[model samples]
Target: MGAHNGVNNMHEVAPMEVSVEAGNFQDAERLDDDGRPRRTGTFWTASAHIITAVIGSGVLSLAWAIAQLGWVAGPAAMLLFAFVTYYTATLLAECYRTGDPETGKRNYTYMDAVRSNLGGAKVVFCGVIQYANLVGVAIGYTIASSISMRAIRRADCFHTNGHADPCKSSSTPYMILFGVVQILFSQIPDFDQIWWLSIVAAVMSFTYSSIGLSLGIAQTISNGGFKGSLTGISIGADVTSTQKIWHSLQAFGDIAFAYSFSNILIEIQDTIKAPPPSEAKVMQKATRLSVATTTIFYMLCGCMGYAAFGDEAPDNLLTGFGFYEPFWLLDIANVAIVVHLVGAYQVFCQPIFAFVERRAVAAWPDSAFISRELRVGPFALSVFRLTWRSAFVCVTTVVAMLLPFFGNVVGFLGAVSFWPLTVYFPVEMYIKQRRVPRGSTKWICLQTLSITCLLVSIAAAAGSIADVIDALKVYRPFSG
Candidate 1:
């Protein structure tokens, strides 16, 4: 398809040029010291992007998932997932490293890199999948955020003996408001704003974890025993083995490695500017930071939640933690979650918008309104533009809201969406380009390993899809 401009021409962009034109740089000398368009981000900016990306709606469910796998398996799975995520991310970096440097400079997007190495059809497929996943993720986050907000409000009401169903009372209004806010946040012009948001989220997370831990300790001391001492904690006589199994299973779903790892890889690509050398180093550093930060956070949160609630930890761990005393702490945590989710939405939203913008430019060359400059307005105002980016966000948001119950479905879509970008396309490109040389056995072995990793990733994504389908069946009525 030829490139055009405007919303109507979105699908007409040739997939090969997706990256080159995404952040069109006309005067590199003016923007960079080396005559290349300088990237206006640093190490921390990359870390924040990766952290926000890795921590999302899925994080709220970590305790529940870990409960299913038990403490040992859950943490182990997270570690393994982190490793896989890093490895695959490295593969993507390698692809960028070997790409045509000139083309890389022009179209540095992930899709452009894939298209340059693979073909048009694969690029298109990857684009569609990526778009679908981001939209699903945005919707899921919005719904989950609404649910969390409602739960907190309801708890507040109940504490004062007030009767109200926060879920039913203002659910629709809150959801729409959240969706709008999410869109606005996603359009923030630079990393400075996002960095501040990330700091807020990090603070909230630490505060929530600390409060939960304190309460658990106090409860133990008050009962004349150390909490989690096994002997000190009382077990309910009526608790059954089956119930424990169910709780553990639920926890396992949250701590599942595949989904979490895939997401980290996606963030690595999204936040960093792609082109070899630069993209490679950025991806490597970002992946390391994301994994390290997320792993520590998950472990700390999981331990604290388990200690505080014991076997009674709610299916959504964050909800249970919020009930811990120091009401202000909980309030901060709530706000933090909201802020973090906003950041997540921005990271997800940008690429979708860029893809749309690229397509629009390709389809309608005459539409000056859809040109890059026109699309680069304030985040809120920019959403109204008839550009591919805006159109994708609007369409995705509506679909996501309509399918609010499809949490697993959204996760599955995200995993699937990441495959071509993070795994398959990268490996294929590396093999085809023969950048490593065919005569070397080490290179062949590396290729085989890369291929194996992609296959495993696909399998993992497939399993997640199955889970989503099953979840959809169980929650069909809620879809309305």
Candidate 2:
């Protein structure tokens, strides 16, 4: 709805006017130069953004996760988490339309909802975790993209111990190159401006997932049975008790992380063009449709890839397969993943960019650099904007280079932020914003689920951190 500032009395503000208000010349002048559009996309485009945000490198690891949990538990966990996240998404959708179901205001961002319901220190806490998760995930995208590229280029030149041989490609240079390309793409001025990117990214996700599943089917047919059928699939069947416990927890974390999208839900909803009454409904539809589509892909990819490779599957599906002559299909799939992650990194980072820009403006009311745009190559660039964003991309790229274990970093990020961003914040904010009765069943069940997720996330986060630490002990820092 309206801003918390009370400058505007109406519930709905035009998308262009977001963060820009009457009497705020800085916000207004910045928009005038940027040509940012408002309320431009329909339901499908909004769903595309949701899909782009939801499906990332996580899908590639699902089969390995299924291997950890076995056939019966793996698909079960995916469906269960999908349903839970979809429900939480709907709750978050309701929070976006806060004041009136018909014409009252709505929250334009996830932080907006947090500020409205759980203000004070919670807002600051939310902002910290939110930006950390965004930046961390962007780093993860860098790591994954670079790894995928390196895998494609050097799959045949690796050592027996998994290190790249001398003369083989390293992830560092590829990461820097990817970051350079992403810095260019990240210059899009508005969230709505990148709808086309999201659409393309979504299509790429479908393409890669389909390819993975098809390759699995082909491999099974060629081999005439499952890859590890003799050894069994479940962790508990052959592994020690301690191994099973850790592996199962990691699997749970991976699946839960795969379903995470709450951090960007409100921002994606802000892209939808509709009347107040229809806005919430449209967002709900988009969320449901995106989740449903991703769920189907996850099932196909996870089950089929597991059937093909079983426990031998690498954390990254693409990396699991050894190099084949004329491996153009695998190369194409990796290219698609890299392209999709380029868009995804921007989608998550845009919020952090907006936050930093707004803070700079508010903290320094008289700074002239905020609105000054100069020509850089073909794009108009602001010194303040370019400086911070480039720094952001650089920070993530350096981190990716430092810790290039793509799956481990992703799990750590998900474990740390999934509870607050995906589960807890939405449920708590909904109950508080809507004033759901303390004793009501809806309140009780939602709160219970949120708490359970928090506890589980804590354990998962600890385990993931241990894995990262163990990885650090052996990994040569900055090694090429």
Candidate 3:
């Protein structure tokens, strides 16, 4: 019940830090004097938050990933990742409840849950990993958004050049512009208040995804059928088994990244206006709806995209769509993607903001912003807030500019974080919190699966990083 109210005010404590000092399970629940539920969001809005987090720039790469495995392996991998992610995500949601399902204590943030079950040391470790992953995601959004914007402009240039000269648009300026746009939304108070933006982002995800699928279908029809060499069953004739295995690993990483909302599950759940007892059910419903909705889009977009371009599908599906006949549609799709990332960037960044601001206030209790007293004129803003938030945005923007390869960088982050943040932590936390016996088959299977996922993700992450380094040999910093 001590959830953030989602709106920032001069008088109230930020929800992320509200109960940190209470030091007990019972204190985790913050209720009004009347003893009613205090959370602020409903099922629909919470689902939208999950959807917005899960289906970001990652969706843009699915076609290229699916192309790695051909039609047979790709869709199957997509379904497998969705199923596993949803199951593990629900396990994490159950961790929020501390006693009887009908009456239990609840933890608001992911670190709160970790501290409760794993102790303070583990909490510190988790914080480092969690914050790093979030910053990585924000950078990924900046890179992906800039790429989308540049794609549209480059398409325009192609026509102007009569298709005889190469397009010369640059992505650096747009990356900074995207960062500036994110800074505006990042200043918005909390997770709950941003529901409208999340809703719009969710809509834009579907819009661009739909547009991609539609264009793919039309292109396929015009071309008479699917065009790639190995669109049916086997890998391309020249693809070595080693190459196929490597590509499959990358594809799995992409699917894992696409389904990753586990890092923000509790934060999103905390936004739902339900008591601890009903929180699990609410989260289950929200996760189910979100995973189902995005899965449909992922499959359609992946399949149709592969069908349209086959081996030719670029790492980004929209960029590969290009400015063909009826090129305006491609432009519209790119714009929708840029708009969606603008919101997605903020949703992921808000938690990082909360974490940083809370720590600074705790360390310097007399600070202007932490004092609950409003300031005016020149003293209107907290220097801490302005300085750190701007720094976070700037850091991410610079990273994106330096490492401009979208698919590889995002995949590396996803592969590295997916195991611990999404799979391993949830399963381990659930087992510890519920006291699932080590000898139990269910317990053994879960641990084994978690370990397997971690190993696979590590290999994928390493491969992704190596691929990025190789690709960077020819990458110009400001080139489109």
Task: Give the runs in model 2 whose Cα sits over 4 Å from its true position.
Answer: 1-40, 155-168, 227-240, 322-326, 376-378
After TM-score superposition, the amount by which residue 328's alpha carbon in candidate 2 deviates from its true location, in angstroms, is 1.1
Q: Tell me the deviation in Å of residue 296 in model 1.
A: 1.9
Q: Which candidate should be chosen as best, given TM-score against the real structure?
A: 3
123-151 per-residue lDDT for model 2 (tens digits): 98888898888888888889989988887
Clashing pairs in 3: none
lDDT of each: 0.53, 0.75, 0.77
Q: Considering TM-score, which of the candidate structures 2 and 3 is the better prediction for this target?
A: 3
Each candidate structure's TM-score, on Cα atoms with residue i matched to residue i, is: 0.70, 0.86, 0.87
Better of 1 and 3 by TM-score: 3
- Against the hidden true structure, what lDDT does model 1 obtain? 0.53
Task: Name the lDDT value of residue 361 in candidate 2.
Answer: 87
Give me the displacement of residue 184 in model 1, in angstroms.
4.8
lDDT of 2: 0.75
Superposed model 1: Cα runs more than 4 Å off = 1-36, 40-44, 99-107, 162-170, 182-279, 320-324, 368-398, 406-421, 432-480
For 259-334, candidate 1 gives per-residue lDDT tens digits of 4434234334433432334655776786677777777766666555555555455545555443544445555566
Location of the lowest summed lDDT over 10 successive residues in candidate 3: 8-17
